[model samples]
Target: MDSFDGFVTGLREQLDGPLPGTSAQLTMAPSYRMTPEQARVEGKSCREAGVLALLFPDGSRVHVVLTVRRDELPDHPGQIAFPGGQREAGESLRATALREAHEEVGLQRDRVQVLGALTPLYIPPSNFCVHPFVGVTAAPPALCPTDAEVAHILRVPLDHLLRPEARRREPWTLHGSTVDVPFFAVDDHTVWGATAMMLAELLAVVRPLYPSLTIPS
Candidate 1:
């Protein structure tokens, strides 16, 4: 098999075993002040959500899809995020992620192969406990973005993310205070917050498989 296929195999193998978990998530977290245990205490009654890190082969490399939320949206407006939403009744987290991806990006459920799940993260701002899953498609998806929810679809090559340079910090105002925010600079988009944290975990899992890729500690 090719390198992309091999990477998929490695990812599936990694998922089947133990995950890097909260330690990985902390690498890209906004603030290290609050630990996962602390967050759990605060998120006792948080709503549940699921997101997909959908990967597919594009030419010779693998790519992951992320969406830019429409500016008019009520939550996280104009922010880059995974295609997902709150869990629905009588559905598994995997199902919820796939359904939301289909609704937001027209990525059919059948086209995706669910690899496995990462650690669930609590978003204190939105009061959401988000469960992220890694999925793969053999071919690139023909995307159809929902104008109401998605402003643009970003298909970022995995190689780009593996590069240490892609991860950077910038000053941003939050809660009336200016703070440095860490983000992945991908395709003219600043992928920060929960999305960045999730990506960090995924990379922590797969980066070791490719010895050539250098990620900062």
Candidate 2:
């Protein structure tokens, strides 16, 4: 897969530069997208967090890790998400991302090569302003899930994300209101909300490099 390697190189270069940002994030956003004005309104009241899109080589392809949270969690219960949580005092966003990944899935910080950061997303339901980072390792890390937080772990191939069919929309009920939600369907998981939105930006950045890989607008 020479083309895939080229795509990864291109993605690394793009991440080093300016990101696609909000325009890209909006592509996979829920019906009611949160605005910067709203985030500012919440201001110091909003929680700050970081998530890692930890990628690794699997056989002949590259894959990223995602987790399904336990239902007992107070926030975003039983939802698909990247490994992350609220930032600890005195920790940088990058450190927070790596630390959370280590705790949630046993992905050690030393194994990850921090690529770059993605656009910050604001989640209205949880009142969290999340900063997402992209990282890669040579091979898949030994994933040991923290039972209290993670219900299951998924290793989604990058190629799957680039497929046009991976993106789908369905009606879902949230907070007593039914809304048409777009998501990335991987295996048996329906990834939506902030996690999907963040992934949209990543795909947008890499899609152009491989014209054959159709990514939903």
Candidate 3:
């Protein structure tokens, strides 16, 4: 098997054990990160949402898909995010992730092999308890976004993320407070907040496979 397949195999095995959990997720969190108790109390009535980190091979390298939301959206507008949204009444979170991906980006649900889930994170601003899942599609998806929700698609190579330079920090004001924000420096976007936290956990899980790279500490 090729390196990508071997990496997937190892990732499946690792997801079976205990996750890196909050420690890994918090690595990319803003300076105003919340405590567990705060997440619980505030998240009591928070809406549940599902997000996916969809991986696939592009040429010989593995790439993950992220979406740039339309600037006019009610919630986190003009932000980089995974292709997912709130859960339906009877749908499982995994199903929600797949369904939302299909609706937003035309991802064929059946073609994706879900490796496992990462730790759930609560977003204070949106009041969403976001559940993250890692899945792999056999091939690159033929993206057909309707432009109603998604403004653009970013297919980022795993190698780019594993490099230390992709992680950067700066001061940003949120809710009238200035806080040091850690974000993934993608092409022109600042990937921070819930999306950055989820990506941090994913990198923590997959970092072992790219040991030669100087990943951010």
Candidate 4:
């Protein structure tokens, strides 16, 4: 079987098992649900979209690619995030994801096979309802970040994410409201906010099958 199939099989098996009791997992699968109107009123009106690259080298080890947004951007500047943007006119979400991926990180469609999508997320600060789609590339990518939008390209080892210690939470005061934001510390770099939320959900879905998958401590 192809590596992608094997990975998905393993992922499914892991998710079917017991759910981890990590903070990341708990926050992603919240205790309460938000209504559509409530979600919209809570700065979720911004309709921005994006993609997540579930890149597997030689279709084996599943790694995730994130970009550091340029400091000049008004929102989410200098943050480690998935390479994605708003959907342009007459474009499909998949197409938009692929196009934005290429523009931001020089990822060619030929290298990636569109797998499917995860649930959409609403980011409050940016007012964007970000849609994260998962795609797998056969080979390791030659990433080139856009100078103006992307400051750096991060190819985070999947194993690192699977390690519980690499991910954590910290206190943050946003618009005078205090809360704990999820953060992933891979080496010296930190990943938080919506990007971390997506990662948490990704882990939720993929963790059931991979028994050895690590949960953040």
Go through the candidates in order and give each one's C-alpha lDDT.
0.85, 0.83, 0.86, 0.67
Clash numbers, per candidate: 0, 0, 0, 8
Name the runs in model 3 displaced over 4 angstroms: 38-43
List TM-scores for all candidates, in order.
Answer: 0.93, 0.90, 0.93, 0.78
Instruction: Report the C-alpha lDDT of model 4 over 1-217, residue by residue, as the tens digit.
Output: 2366787656545445553323343453222222334223244447768676555654346678889888889876788888888889888888888888998888887777766665566655566777777777656788898648799988877766777777676777766776666578976677876677677767666654356665643
Model 3, 40-145: lDDT tens digits are: 3243678999989999988888899999998999977899999999999999999999999999999988899999998888887788888999999778878877
Looking at candidate 1, the ten consecutive residues that score lowest on lDDT are 32-41
lDDT of 1 by residue, 87-127 (tens): 99899989999999999999989989999998888887788
Q: What residue runs in model 1 are displaced by over 4 Å at the alpha carbon?
A: 32-34, 38-43
Instruction: Evaluate model 4: give its TM-score.
Output: 0.78
Model 4, position 91: C-alpha lDDT score: 86
Please give the distance, in angstroms, between residue 182's alpha carbon in candidate 1 and its true position after superposition. Answer: 0.8
Lowest lDDT block of 10, candidate 4: 29-38
Q: Rank the candidates by TM-score, best first.
A: 3, 1, 2, 4
